[model samples]
Target: MSIIVQEQTGLFHLQSSGMSYIFQIVEGYPVHVYWGNRLKHREPMSDLLIHTPKKAGLDRLPQEYPQYGSGDFRNPAYQAELEDGTRITELKYAGYRIIKGKPSLTGFPAVYVEDEAEADTLELELVDAYSGLQVVLSYSIFSDRNAIVRSARLVNEGDKKLRLRRALSASVDFQGTRDFEITYLTGAWAREGNITRKPLHQGETRFDSKRGMSGHQFNPFAALVTPQTTEYQGDAYGFSLVYSGGFEASAEVDSFGSTRFNIGVNSFDFAWLLTPGESFQTPETVMVYSGQGLGELSRTYHRLYRTRLCRGKYRDQERPILVNNWEATYFNFNADKLVSIAEEGAKLGIELFVLDDGWFGKRDSDNSSLGDWVEDRRKLPGGLADVAGRINRLGLKFGLWVEPEMISPDSELYRKHPDWCLHVPGRRRSEARWQLVLDYTRQEVRDYIYDSLSAIFSSVPVSYVKWDMNRCLTEIGSAELPPERQSETAHRYVLGVYELLERITTAFPDILFESCCSGGGRFDPGMLYYMPQTWTSDNTDAVERLKIQYGTSLVYPASAIGAHVSAVPNHQVGRMTPLEFRGDVAMSGNFGYELDLTKFTEEEKEIVKRQVAAYKEIRGLVQKGDLYRLKSPFEGNESAWMFVSENKEEALVYHFQVMAVPHPPQRYLRLAGLHPELEYEVQSGDSEDKPIIGGDRLMHLGLPLAYEQKDYESGWFRIRAVNPGKA
Candidate 1:
């Protein structure tokens, strides 16, 4: 534990169980009936109060309630009820210490605040890990009800330098119910309208909520489906409003399971490597409510998710199992090679064939050919339409990949109009993964992307698009705009992308889009507002994937995680895990494969057949069921994960040993969110038990954790077919 409070400022502290990071609220500015259980201070800490504009006088600030109609607290705050109950007061006291801030030794200083109108907006300046490394994040805050207001920017005054080797994050907490249900998801990096293809409106960049959700993603970010609640129990619910983003994320609820949150993160954007000077950030929020289902949360978020379309009509829920060719083919191609794989894929019940990153242009690899959206006839003699036809004939939906915002220097588009890239025309530009970022803030560029994609979808029975944004913005200078408008590009770029997605999804309701940034570089709530699912990771090995997927599931639903079985000697980690084990592990979420099945041996094919069979059996349970995280995957001992039936009729449990030992005795494990009085028959299958399972038996008897020597590697876990709600 560490507590380092600035003199006369709010108390500062941080601690962890070593497995997960934990934070406690100490003394701070008192709000309307400021409500947090006082934590025991183990060490001597000074009690100090620091207020801004001190001479303004702290009196008349209202102790029993908030200064109604006073001002905005967009930085983030916890709320205490109002005096008359007409409204609630939320306050975000200033903190002197920064978790990760500006002039960072390596990157830039960063902070996020809701625009006065309350849309997630960020302000920062970062160093480029890659050359031409300059970044600008600025936006005017006003308009939307959920927007951020004028935020105090963290700056690099030249004298200060900071470096963050690992992911540096800033979290904004919401003041909500201790007893409430919260929902979160990550996807969407697109939208519709001209939003900002011109004189960067730093002031008008917020959505007009009165318009009933216009120009945002498929869903909006941080929604409160139900009204706030002020109840929590045990040692839980401290930060009733807190959110973080890194390689992965998670949340903790009390034993009731009553305070449920079906947090769904767009599975793609699995991981990112930000070296010394790069900066990364996410728009995180806390949705507070007391009781209800996931639908309620969706309803609230959708209400605020500014868009020109209606999600109610497009509620075509359920993400399809996708087979991405990138992991299999790796840019080297031939239509024949893909067709062969699609044939096997159809047989295994794969629903979509996503041709990732290389089906177009002179793009033989990731190095070149990004901006040229035209089909590269050299790779596929017959063209994209022909490839789509072949895949459709194989009884599967065809999906194409496009990094629409990037242009390769070697490509036709880039060569023809070099000035089209994000640069000052005379100045140099930055490049990552062998491609330059297209200026999305430009109207013509955005139009080209929208038109090209709509044309492509029109040419074939394309059901999905794997929209990829491989890197963050850098060396920010756009020659197409005036100097004053140049800094507005970053914010405008986002709005432009959202504008494109809104139009596409509205036009093609049947077509689904998956957002990906590198392997999992840009996993944020902003993205989830558009796409329903995302590629969880580039790492497909089962053993290593368990942790990656586990951490992902903390705030995201299983349905959003795009997991697949690929050839062993996992490309990323190089661990040669068994094919069955890989398939079985992936079965826990959106199931698919990343390897070339056509090249697989006969035995491997048979294993896939069985794997498909297993997936079909557990699909419903995994998609809609209640999830539980048993042991720490980060910890070497026994690790466990399970999915309980949506209706509580069945339960599927899967356990793996990170580090196994011989002669281990039967260990007892306590199941979470289970009822004791309900007698449950533990006869294999994911189910809801009807009979009295008994609290004593459940709590006292405990679950059998120690498996037989052979059962350990064999991956032993019971699939209890339950009859919940019965006698």
Candidate 2:
């Protein structure tokens, strides 16, 4: 049996007459490889040979090359690495046999030497193709040393426009219904429940109780189960990303015995229509392997997702915990007011000061102006940068908020360019908040937004952008595109918005970008491509946020949320709570204070002072920590969770009292992490009272319930046990 292996790991590589590597299964899972080496510039064949894994029936595979019977080419330079550690850098068209890399397809274990041969013996057969309406059968193999992962491109070289539905189904000859779990990092971790038992394992299982069947689809994991073809008559199907191919990785995972795997996407999905030789492109990939369990498979999958597929193209940076002022001061604060809040914020360790909506346009409040990206002159005598500079000079970074795709009817942009709105040019245009949506699908729209933002960033010391999308698709239709192209509106709108963001980010790679569509509306991997973090929601109430934040964190890292301590009588839900309760709730996230700080009474201000102090002391521990929910919101009267840093040096626990209970014995709480054999002293965050306790106190004795929660009040107990050595 022969296998193929490629050892080079370049972000992008150029090639002639071949598909690019979108997803490469290295050992047993897939890894991402940027394959667009400046298009049209091909490279000399490197000693790169892609390898196949080793298995029983698939051991002795012959090296095979595709014979071009349909096209006029004697031979194409093929690359492969054999099951042994040797690489095959050249290929000659033989009769019908091609060596199997990893049995990417099922049938053959040997690399084929045939130029062209009968279809029966081969595991995968290219059944049909022409004008982008392509279909085929495939297998997942990883048993050969030197092999060929397939790559196919269907160009729209026909005369009339054609409608097409494309599908590629895998018919792996597995012994039985292969058992595998399909997990997704979607819905956030459950907010309210009894602390869940540690999953039988950590890295393998999803933290949520909500599980679905299908196969883990990537981060937005979903099994491509049975693919269905869509029919298209005109431009609706003009362009498609439908293509598929196959390949395998080294049998044993690098320097380690575990196998690493990657898949190629030059071929496998999408249906496209062609018009008189106009071309449409589709990419594909298929991978197969025999593995012990998902643990190995997941390790391979995660690396590929992060290294290659995460296209935002930025190194991992600590996501900023920003507080937008719109929700805090509304459109009412002046430069001095803004400055005062920021100064207090900085003293409390806030990182960035964001100016939200109503800071632009010819008016005030949420109703008047959106399309106007200019800094509101009435709001501040100086420009936007002046305020940003003020915040920056105050030892904090500055962030600006923009609703680029929205325009209010009362604004200048709509009055001058009514045609740019989404409705029919004649019929009543839909208006919410007396605002119309921008035609982000158009290039002109993108250019205008790009230049305006570029000018702002250039003029100020801006380091972050709170990219917010407030509304969903209300008025669906668009008069701009042709009738057949209307369905492309939503998808294209998203993609176009992404394109504009992509351009902006490329231009200003240093600026951190965040995406929020009314809080999690566009919360998918697609948006994460450009914006690393997102505003978790419009709801900031501590009680309500317990679930929202918990659910959101299950899939996204904790840093993604723009959490803050809003004023009591919660803005969204008018329930007033203590300031301490509010701060403790927001502390678990990218902590920041949002309420107008100066308005508080002297007593309230002191609480604010202590709250800020608490955050400062534990911010690092909270930011870089492992979260374990000690009590699930659903199963208990109260919610309790603990945050432990990567190092066991520090720990903070948040216990929220949801109900009134009778005073009982000593308060006992069984904690998840602590040295089972070590002893240390424990005390409340503010109290100097000493209570030298042992792990047994936390694990066996547990803290008893002694007090009841005030109707709207909450409790936060910070625990720091002295390390025995340090003591």
Candidate 3:
């Protein structure tokens, strides 16, 4: 049984395929005790729960969902103001149940189970009797993985209204104050998702996104680890919020010397006013504990999110290799130019041709015609259908780019209804990229966007859509909503985005959707839940992508990263890298091209052909296989990564040297995820004949790599099992 309840001890032990989470009810209050490697047997909790020098009302005790009114002094996961206007909360376990399958989150995107046999969820109902606020804490254990998903649902069963100031999704309490460190992702627009690690001090270490959108400043992820944790050993706990709005996650050491971690919606400018019978469901939080190190921790997240969190027809399918015309011609292409580029692309084996930004209504530049979905006949003399049909005739699929979340003041739609934009009267509207945000909270606005998309899809033969949001929210006010509900604008806007995505994606299941926000500004689990992949970053330079891709792999999978080889002097970074290195780096993700094929030399054209063929051959393995981070770019001048097939039959390794070093020694890469007893054959571009080696020696002793002493150099290798053995 995945979930076991001990009635006598009031202990609930939830076990996934490889880990366990145990919590027990003490004096009608659920207290968190252990979460780590699975325990083979249950032990007595009398000694575990005993705390000397107790504070008032057990507030010092470690709890699953700590409350304010209780004796615990640390930050409470649940907090609210009662009728008397005092913020105090005290909840006791009221009831519980082991359900057959995982429940879904209403009005938000979350992981789902297709069958009851896939997972089992344990729901514990807790209630604060004085305020009549009921919180249902849920823990879902996967039938075949070592990860557990957690979320909370708050119900206002009281007669009077309650204003919730803080309601986090999950909190974990660790018994020891062992030396620990926190690892998270942080960077700017073009340079995003760089991994940073620092010692976890006694106070609080927090990471959040309050920029209305999940801005490029921080990804919605955090990790707590002991000092001894490494790539393959020690303990590492990862926390990722399946949300894209403003959120907060922190790890704190309280006065009692216990480490507490919490993650949920940002309470900093957040207040939910709940009336009678209204329930609020927090977004899901996925927690994974890896005793084997940070690499295993990442693989766990990658596997879980790839299978359960992401849903669509393309979720498990191999994505096509497309050429985007954004950097090729920017916003100055006509239908004839697009068709000519598509013709050249088809000749080079590209599968799709994407018509980016400028194809829409008078959008020759970023300044005007947003929120106007009509095709600009000036740019595309032939309408969208004619261009799409021409591209189809060239033996390639057609894709269109759209920025449905922003509207320009110069647009026809904005002139018709200026109130449709998110603005408050008497306040100057702020614009980013020369565009203001559409008030998504308004049903009419959402309907208009949806209908516009539907009409386009129905008129054209588009097989893909690059959904973009170029700006963050500012001047946060909605003309349609009253002043009392002004604080709800951020959360409501995200929900409205989800509604539009759900409606359109569901209506066109076959269309491959890719999320973008001026590169990867809005990349998060919430977006991946709707779209299978996201543009990794606007910095397409191969040298820069090494760090970006490496940092992103700490949480996201290869299938969720969109990488492309662009022309050098790269558009964003202006770095001139070799075409081969560019292709090598892009092959680590959903491979594509962002360069002009019409301008390529004959030699460069041949290289593109070979790259297309190579990527198509191994894309299945890279997309679905187990990924291993060989070396981090953050730690050194080189970056290396590998992907191993699930059956341990094949492996692909990528090695990159960011800068050339004087008198550098040969590098040895230790392979992962191979059967130690089996024999494997290895091959590379420089090797004359395939060499066979024992997987045990290859992993323990490592394999030596030979490369040129040049900046921005790369090497690729493939290994196949020669003898079958259990992994």
Candidate 4:
């Protein structure tokens, strides 16, 4: 059993592969005592609780989920309003059980397990005796990974409807720290996932996304670490919300110096109605602890999410090399032009051809024809079937892009059913990208979207879909919901979107789905539960991508990052770089192309073919290997990263120099995760006479590199283990 409960002391200790979490009942409330490295034996700490006589029964003790207006006043983990309009909630422990398998969220996406041998779960029940509100907290511990998934389900057992003002998914209380820091991801669109770390103060520090969709400004992840913690040293704790909706993650330090970490659906402009006999489940929060520092914490998250969170055919499979038409032709292509591009891509060994936006309705520009799903005769006179068939005949799979969450006011659908959009009765409907958001909370609206896309997939032999949402929410109102329930609009919108994706993805399990929202605006774990990958960003410049990709690797795996090589004088940054540098950076992710190949010169075409062939050879290592950040772009002008296979048989290293200086010093990069006893042979793009070095020397002594190139230059190398018996 992963969980052990002491009958005498009312204590429970949950253990994962290398971590342990402990909690106990003090009086009637569950209080968190310890969470860190796993103990070798079951020894209860009698001195875990600190007795405070100054504020008796106040906010001294660390609680699993603190309640407001109940004497113990700090930030609350659960808050609600009764029918009588009171916001007080006094919840006491009711019961608990240790089970074998994990439970699923009712209307939300969560990590799951197939068999009882894979994991064990503990369910703790708490009830507010006055209001008849019951909250069931679940904790699942994987048998082989250092992770625990936590979530809560609220059941209304009273006759009156209960309005949820705040419902956080998970919270953890840590003992007082000497010095603490919080690390989170923050950036704007086209430059997402820049890691920022700061000292944790006495008050509250928060990272929130309230734009209906998980906005580009903040990702739903947070980490707590001591000031001495580094990438490969000290202790670190990571917390990630498995949700793509608006969310809030906060770290609060109390007067006594202890810290509380919380994450869930953003309570700002958010509410849920729980009538009698109804229940609402929050999304899961995955927590991982690493005694070996931030790098191991990231590797744990990467391994668990890559195998358990993401699903379907493309989850563990190598993604096909695709060529997108957005950067190439935009909205200026016809059927013949698309076919011509597909032919050129096929000759260069690209496996899939994606026809980005403008193939549906009259979408000649971003201003019009969004919700109309019909094929436009002006652009593709032969319709989708004809175009897909032509692409298929070229020995390439067909992919189409659609922004289904937004509707143009000028489109036919909006003209017929204007109430289908999210608008108040009198206020003007705010628009982004010249379009209004659809009121997905309406079942009718969800049905319309699902049926429309289903029909298209059935008509055309489409093997892939680039599901996109172009803008964030504006004018937060729902026409179908009541005035009191207006605050439920944004959260319910996300639930509806997840439902639609679940239905479509489950129905077409073989098709590859990639999520996009104005270029990574909604990149979170929840989307990866449905789609295998997400477009990293709109910026394809190699130097910029180095920072973006490095920051993203703190939580996400390389397989989930959609990267592509674009035309020179890059569309986003307008800086020309070497083709090799672009290819090296792009190969660090799910490799593909976003440029026009037909216009490439003979030499450039040869380079493209070489890059495609090279990526194919090491794609498995790049996608599924353990990532080690040798040199951070944020810390220096040079960025160096390495990927080593789990078996330690193969490795790939990427090194980049952002700027060149006269008479530069020689640099040596020490590799990671290699077996010290094994010998390996290194190779670099058909270069011969490479030395055979021992893994210990490579890791401890380091590999030397020449840094004499100009600005924005990069290089890659591959190493294969030499079997002792053969040598």
Query: Please, what are the lDDT tens digits per residue for candidate 4 over residues 1-727?
Result: 8988875677888887788888888777888878889865455555554344665674777888888896866778889899999998888989999889887787788888878878899999999989999999999998888899999999998889899999999988886764679999999998998999999989899989878877789999989988999988888999999998899999998887888899999988778899999888889999999988889989998888888889988888988899999999998999998898899999889999999999988888888887789899888888999999999999999999998999999899988998988888888988888999998899999899888899999889999899999888888888888888899888888899999999999989989999999888988999999998999888899889998899999999999999999998999989898898899999999999998878889898899899989888888988899998889999998898889999888899999998986787777888888888889998765578578989899999888887655887788879899874442
Candidate 1, 220-273: lDDT as tens digits: 223223333211112222111111111222222323221212222111222222
Stretches > 4 Å off in candidate 4: 43-55, 724-727
Residues 331-429, model 2: lDDT tens digits: 777888888878877765567777777677765777877777888777787888788888888988888778887878888877788777666555676
TM-score of 4: 0.98
Worst 10 residues of 2 by lDDT: 231-240
Error of 4 at 479 (Å): 1.7
Q: Which ten residues in a row have the lowest lDDT in candidate 1?
A: 191-200
Q: Model 3 scores what on Cα lDDT? A: 0.88
Cα lDDT of model 3 by residue, 406-519, tens digit = 999999999998999888889999888899999999999999999999999988999999999999888777888777678778888899999999999999998999999988
lDDT of 1: 0.49
* Model 4 lDDT, full chain set: 0.88
Off-target runs (Cα >4 Å) in candidate 3 are 43-57, 686-688, 725-727
TM-scores across all candidates?
A: 0.63, 0.62, 0.98, 0.98
- Candidate 3 residue pairs in backbone clash: 59-71, 59-72
lDDT of each: 0.49, 0.47, 0.88, 0.88
Q: How many clashing residue pairs are found in candidate 1?
A: 74
